[model samples]
Target: MDEITEGTSQVDCDILVIGGGTAGPMAAYRAKKKNPNAKVILLEKANVKRSGAISMGMDGLNNAVIPGHSTPEQYVKEITVANDGIVDQAAVYKYAQNCYEIIQELDGFGIRFQKDENGDFDVKKVHHIGTYVLPMPNGDTVKKALYRQLKRARLLISNRYMATRLLTGKDGRIAGAIAVNTRNAEFLVVRAKAVILCMGAAGRLGLPTSGYLFGTYENAANSGDGYAMAYHAGAGLANLECFQINPLIKDYNGPACAYVAGPFGGYTANNEGMRFIECDYWSGQMMQEFYNELQSGKGPVFLKLNHLADETIGEIETILHEVERPTRGRFQVNRNNDYRHGMIEMHISEIGFCSGHSASGVYVDDNACTTVQGLYAAGDMASVPHNYMLGAFTNGAVAGEHAIDYVNEVDFADIDEDFIAAEKERVLAPTKRDDGIPPNQVEYKTRRLVNDYLQPPKVTRKMQLAQDRFAETRAVMENEMVARNAHELMRSLEVSSILDCADMAAFASLFRTESRWGLYHNRADFPERDNENWFCHSILSKDDAGQMTIKKKDVDPYIIPIEDEEKDAYDKQRIKAQA
Candidate 1:
């Protein structure tokens, strides 16, 4: 049990939730629901006004239900396959089984989804399939809905609040957290019995990929903050190495972030301008399940054109204009590199965004509880279920429910205010005064390293040299990385950022020993998916001293029964998915 000391000026609460996004709020909301007397607080780095990565208007739940074709079992099966068989099976099942309840719970609130003429939930409209997920809405609708619930529950919600680190009581229990109100520049020390980390993955943060080079959805502020704080606070983390990359993002031109910007579309064009498909019908060549097309010139490819002036161009124009952000990192691409010296902007059409959506986070058992006491994680930050809409909500709800249960079990006691005050001063230390190097400068260099060294589908000997150079350059930056205020804090963050994710990624890359599918990780040295020795999930963990170690957690296909003769069924289902 945790309690705040009397006259503890700045600290408050029974549970402190980092992130007011999808999973964080649910955890906070559910925590309060279980213990009415418990004080719950949610902190968001940005506004609670919108869902960060996937947009706020449409929470795209995977709605894959057919008459008798799909079940939770089938969905789980497909999910594991889609993830390349490295998922936590129990966690997936728990989430899959209870996904509908989460959606129904959401619907019970004011959040609405599309429906058919029969007046049933029109989930399929939001997602391509409906078996596992609710075909959820975006952050605008989904986040606001969650916010409404958070408000109704009276859980304290703070926007633009940055969680500096997880706070542990003298008893070694994770009692709460330390944070800064980014807007007011004030330190906040929250003492709680439990803490939930719901920040998404380290993948989309311009991690070594086309997102850095081509501008695919990099949420800069996120910067693996949750993962860093957790690691710093002695929280056991797993799968830090496996941040999923989007295949479509790689194949697209212009800002890669626009890949998932509008509706799910994949318009792939080759150097010679040819269309490629997940399952190409024009010929009989089998579409490689997941391969790197960026350098191989064969992985999943999306086309880039130079105009969109047709009759129905209005729709794409509307979405594109609204969501388009300028490209910055590696490709410094304006309207020229993609179209070539101002040839004219192109509207990617026909194809849709494909999934390379697995990511890494905290290792949780069936209950989403990390090895650390009184610590919980959900969504991308919590390990399990990487980058899909349906998966996020499903697992998020499970973690939320379990977190509340954990919160209620703990008895209330007094928390130490002195520790919190000290934490606040530490967080304010960086900002109270500026480290010489701007956070962006360090980030840009890091992004370049990722762009050159990590970005793959293996180019050539030159790229290998580039990678070596990247390591050397990054080492210097980290060695000499200096900071003053927030920028200084960020410099330290960047240093940890590379090691935090890179250690995991580097180890995972080394162990897999082969470039399996094109999900960000690529080994030019070994360019093939070696199923015999390495067809497994790349599991990573940090020890008490923050040393990263990687292991292979193989997927046992036997958990869900399969007919010996029905192997074709698996292939068929996969084919349908690719289609």
Candidate 2:
């Protein structure tokens, strides 16, 4: 590794994996495994032991794609229908094909998945068309499992270093990345042959209705850093308007774990205590039905586990309280609520970009390769529909293996000193200001605007106004936002990322005139879905003049073609029994 001197801190590696969350550690592990001699470095904003989306751990695999349980073709088609047919089938197909492999690998790593009496993987039907949700009874230690593997791989791990930007070489390929220590405020320059980003999602882009900034469905730290870095590096981000809005525990702002509890006879119910949607699987159509039920005369939705047996409810509590958010039980107890006696109130989550649940992230091919050479993305940050946790692991392996091959073909590129100096100046500017806007205040205002204008049933005028307000907010972030310490500096940088995502969301929403993805990208003005011109993926990138540009990219021809009947399967998510 050729180290380039940039002040006091200089680090070099054969491959650099940013965001040591669900996908990142796996990527680092696989990169080292693929090329044992090459040095692989993993960077994280927090401890690798527990961070990102699965910080608490996953409830279950939303898309297992297990062999006997489901096929890649079937899994691909289900995701295609779920996303309103605007997905790159190849990308989803790749995830489907390889995810099962990772599930078994995780099993070897000591992460347990629930199995049947016959010793078969217990897969449940949650989607409109497939049985993919695999419960993890002891999944709270998923991060621990990954951490063990990362340690065994003997890779370098840097914790509390938040990567802010991707450094490009003279040839315009990924050379390395720039980051800062959230603990000490020391700037870091990582020079590498290849870089992989697994920065989770833009979870903090929208303020939760609870009025708490940290109370988001996704990990609070995932404030669109990957999206911002990828965009600035000139990578294409797909379906920014197809935001991630989950049916979460109201006010508490965490998953209600319908995917885990649904099979145990738990269902989403309206105030009348009747099931509204047929499937609990999260999709745009499912959320639309959820939103409509809340708006309907029988308002306020609830996760109805009151009908379950005491034994079943006990089992549910064990899984819910122990895994995933873990705070669901505490939050419920504070309200004096129990699943056996009362239903848990549910609400639609704040809008943000997360390809793990929704189809909005940096575009990547089957191998996790982005448009920019030597730059790859996986996990919630990569554009693969309904990928969930298993997808992140599988895609991480793909990116890591491919990145090793990529680095072998290309030699290390020199880092430009001027570019490094400019980025350093920009990052440190917030701390330099004696008195300026606090990052939290700026974030709150920007996210409030996100909810006011960009949260869907979007309107042309509202989105237009959103653009104007976003521009002003971006200016505030660029000029006025202040950071007193390294932690505040992290927040300040995250605010910038959130602003970038806000701009992308507003511009992308306005660009796609037709409303699609059900409640996700619903335009009140254009209430109808226009497949004629809008069927293709809405790709966004920074133009030459540094303005956000949107263009329609043809969806890669489907490997597993969707039947006409199957296309509308997601559109009819509401149960006829409710009607």
The reply for model 1, stretches above 4 Å from the true place, is 1-9, 63-69, 122-140, 169-172, 183-185, 203-216, 247-275, 279-356, 411-435, 458-499, 554-558, 562-579
* Per-candidate local distance difference test: 0.52, 0.89
Q: For residues 1-579, could you state the per-residue lDDT of candidate 1 as single tens digits? A: 111112322666667778765667677777678777877777787776574554434434543333343566765665555444556677767766776667677778776655658867643221222232333333235666666777788878787667777777667678777665544455566777778887765642343333342243434444567776777667656544344443333324333322322233323444444443332111001123333233355423433433433433433333333332312222324323432222222222111111214445677766878767888777766666533555556665666667667766785444667866666544444343323444456566655555554444434454445546556655645454554444345344444554445434444455556654344445667766567987666555666565756666656454565444532222321223233
Q: For residue 408, give model 2's deviation from the true position in Å.
A: 0.5
* TM-scores vs. true structure, each candidate: 0.74, 0.97
lDDT of 2 at 286: 88
lDDT of 1 at 64: 32
Estimate candidate 2's alpha-carbon lDDT, on a 0 to 1 scale. Answer: 0.89
Best by TM-score: 2
